[model samples]
Target chain A: MLSETQEERKMAEGEEVKNKQVLFRNYIDGFPKESDMYISTENTIRLKLPQGSNGVLVKNLVLSCDPFMRLLMQKNDDSGLFGCYTPDSPITGYGVAKILDSGNPKFQKGDLVWGMTGFEEYSIITETESLYKIEHTDVPLSYYTGILGMPGITACAGFYEVSTPKKGETVFVSAASGAVGQLVGQLAKLMGCYVVGSAGSKEKVDLLKNKFGFDDAFNYKEEHDLTAALKRYFPEGIDIYFENVGGKMLDAAILNMRIHGRIAVCGLISQYNLAEPEGVKNLMPLIYKRITMKGFSAFDYLAHYSKFYDILLPLIREGKIVYIEDVAEGLEKTPAALVGLFSGRNIGKQVVVVSRE
Target chain B: MLSETQEERKMAEGEEVKNKQVLFRNYIDGFPKESDMYISTENTIRLKLPQGSNGVLVKNLVLSCDPFMRLLMQKNDDSGLFGCYTPDSPITGYGVAKILDSGNPKFQKGDLVWGMTGFEEYSIITETESLYKIEHTDVPLSYYTGILGMPGITACAGFYEVSTPKKGETVFVSAASGAVGQLVGQLAKLMGCYVVGSAGSKEKVDLLKNKFGFDDAFNYKEEHDLTAALKRYFPEGIDIYFENVGGKMLDAAILNMRIHGRIAVCGLISQYNLAEPEGVKNLMPLIYKRITMKGFSAFDYLAHYSKFYDILLPLIREGKIVYIEDVAEGLEKTPAALVGLFSGRNIGKQVVVVSRE
Candidate 1:
């Protein structure tokens, strides 16, 4: 299979091939647009790793479009967590790839792996520490970009570890049709919780109630008063809140929170594209209701990936859980797919298919 | 002593006597003013418990002027935690009292106690569940209002349990000279943490540094930019933040918090007077830093009062802990003293001395 691709390009073992990539133009201020990045076919990469360089040369197959990528597009000053994207360079993110050649003993040629990689056809991943070998071929390889990957671990950790959910509790999740929210709502239902969700469109709301099995769902865009909308759904008050969208959604959730409720803040998608994020004013409820609002990420719980896999894999195989993805066909659609996240353009998890192999 | 007081007023054990009280005129909107409550001497009460009623009649001594009392002045709709003040009624609060007559076996005549009572010369405490007998009198009686009462338990629970402080970590306390903040700062220092505090005035700052044994102190009022001011103090970032004053101070502290930092939301005195509390704008750091912000109260930890008393009592007896009180003489001054809290008028723990007896 490796020789066939090399022969198609008319290249030898150590020969160079044209590497098409999407390069970030510069640091952006507000919402990202397709113009912020440019597609380039001017770069070339050797199929083999250089001698004494312990790196894996991989052929990029699938790329993920996540909300956190927007933060990387900004010039970070003090937040040392994310490595900001450099201008005129291929943007790096979580992706699935096939190793073509390797100087590292951990990965061999033709091995499939998923983790951090460049958004290019073929490249050398110097920091192979972030990559994990794919052993389960029974699942779709693109599942590594959503359910079996970052978003999967995020839902497990946020619901179980951060939210501290219990059976029969009332729960509310915002951005119900998104990658993490969909999984969380389903997981809450499995725990026997009375779950309600809010999304942007009617289609997403239908998917949440009928597809994800949320007890009830609402279209937040149609509701002028979010606090009233939440109160209408949760007449008794919410016991746990899976906070995906910040701004007014967060403020309203606080008001409707039960005594000693927990809010697992996984993302603030509503504020990511704004020049200045909206301020949350109803925090006084935290004191009055004795609420706990904690912030966490999948990276923080990566060590428990095996535990997450054990819990979710069975549910997936038994038909107890389902996943949805909106896959863009080619790498050229990467920029638009990523930008679409801010405008609620995608129906579910957004992924860009770079190559089938 | 009870007989002497009854004889001085020319009243028998079952006779009526003039009861001067400060009555709440109406529910307030913003900051409470002295005019919001009026001193009335027309009320009279029988100096004895009612037949078949398990209640205690007591003479009020020292009353606590706490920030939470401001919250009760508002019209409460859903916050069932606090019982709101009724129009044309004696304002209720924490106070030290001497029992004159008792219908319950738990409390006897001439026993000194501290708990919830009316802000008047005399009060019939129907709920004996909230009161605790004063067994140890070696410390000043006024200490019960500041260091040995609700505020004392608040500091102990917030610092040790909620914040989860580790030795040699960094701690920042806002409103450092107040009842709870003062004790929290000292407790953090005793645990070997590098402690810094922010207060409203230079005098309070001096007390925090020199008297309360805080490692560093600053006057937050003098600084135009609170975020820069916090960064100057906590260059390495803060591990634990004892949040007493909310609004801009909370925003500044969020920006300066270390990874996995804990914020104990004890009070929000700064926002008590505002019609609309300020919205915190820098909460994104909670996600980047993976911070935990929890809200708690002394009432939640009342079951652990023995544990708190065991720890704080020894520190007070050995002079390892020092308490400062801004005692306003006479019951008529209760309204003025409480109103002073919003303006940063009183230093240390504000207390009203109803009677020295």
Candidate 2:
């Protein structure tokens, strides 16, 4: 997979190439549709960096479609930490890339890296600090966008750092079949916990129970009373809740939490597309239960990436951990792949293959 | 204040007394009304404990009228941590009492104590473990129902322990003129933090600024846009929010929290009377800001009561800490005093003087 053509090897450093890119059309209000983004081939990039530049230029391999990306599509207040996507420009997200050229000494040509990159064939990332050189590639490169990248680190920080699970404790994860939830459930199981998950579809529910090794799984769409459904599964009550789908699910989880329960707020994918987010009504239970609910982002835990990598890499090598991905081929399919997240369309970690090389 | 009449001292241990009681007529649904409770003198209680019973018989002194008692007035599921008030029975709550007779070795006759007791002239408390022998009489005995008891410890734990406040940080407290919020604001100020509080009335707002020494205060009822109001007061953002009133206040506080802000959930006086608690809409800010929202009760911090007492006793005696209380006279005024909390009718810690000695 690392082999380069003789033409690419002989190509001059200053050579130019056509770049196929996915561009954000405009700020979206409701659920993002495929038309909110468009594929463009009019842009081009040089194979060399500008003089005195400290950026890294790379060819994107696999791009990740995450729920947080939807938040970037909306018109955000400047007060928030994240910046919104610029219209008519290439949308940026986490991806695995092969360095085509570099002005920074830390990265060299052909170095495999995974971090923030454009949803295009080529990107000149000015923030070199955002990129991390991929240390081990013995496993599938696509895993860098799922199990070995942002989603993987998210599960590690959320489960081990935030949730603080103890042995034999009961755990519940919302949006359990998604990239982060799947990993959290597996991590809880590895810690000898009774893990239960809730998803929107029967296929994802089956995957959670059979493939992810969750002790129990339920289809939230099929449950009319979420509180009652959770009570049935966790008769004793939930000890840790990995919150992904907020709104009513969060309300229901609050009611079923045990004393001193911890809720790790990862993402609220359920409320991202709504004009107004649904209200959480059961917070009163938090007082009597002595619960702690914390919200965190993956960027905060990147400093400890090595520690997480050391723990997870071995599990993957020994077949103790399993990762599932729904890959969409070609940059042209990026729009549909990204839009599918809001509707729970893609089955596992949604990824768009921009380039096989 | 500890003196008893000669007749009381000579009375036989098994003598019965005319117990004037405030009985909970029935399970209530909404804001508890004065009519929901009735003054009853039909019941008589024996001063002596049953044979082999390790209970203490006490004559009530000062009774606490708290917001939590409203929760007990409603029919509750047995799953919750606290028990509900039984129909046609004297409602139970925190109070200061003088032990008339004791079968438990932990308590002695004529000893002053404060703990859970019936809302009557006399009560036989079987759970002697709940009682704490009053150690100091230098402060007003009525202080046991407010600054020296539950509300004081609540403020100590929420501010110093849960909020993890730092000097120069900003603090916001809702229901600021009330028992818990008033102490929380003062505690933050004592730690060299800037403090702001919100209450329902202009009088409370004035008391917050002038009497409690809060940096600023607001009348929430006058603020049409709570988020905008909070933003105006805390342009830099709130670091610690001692949450007393939930619903819109919580929603507004969430929007104004700084990065890594902490919210200590002490009480939700605003939502206690509602048939359905209001939904909190701004919880999404918690993620981007990496905020921690925790719910805690004073009972959890009781083990450290002696440590807290050592710190607070001097503050009260030296005039460094001032406590304001709304004292209602007579046992018959108990129902009206308890019912006034929901309407913001009480100015400070609501206490009923059941007996002076």
- The TM-scores of all predictions, comma-separated, are 0.97, 0.98
Local error of candidate 1 at A114, Å?
Answer: 1.4
What is the alpha-carbon interface RMSD for each candidate? 1.0, 1.2
User: Across residues A218-267, which tens digit of lDDT does each residue of candidate 2 receive?
Assistant: 99999999999999999999999999999999999999999999999999
lDDT of 1 by residue, B1-357 (tens): 234555335434477888889999999988899999999999988887778879999999999999999999999898937879999999999999989889889999889999999999889999999998999999999888878999999999999999999999999999999989899999999999999999989899999989999999999989999999999999999999999999999999999999999999999888887899899888788888999999988899876688889999999999999999999999999899999998989998999998887
- Candidate 2: misplaced stretches above 4 Å? A1-3, A6-13, B1-3, B6-10
Task: Fill in the DockQ of model 1.
Answer: 0.75
Best by DockQ: 2
Give lDDT: candidate 1, residue B341.
Answer: 92
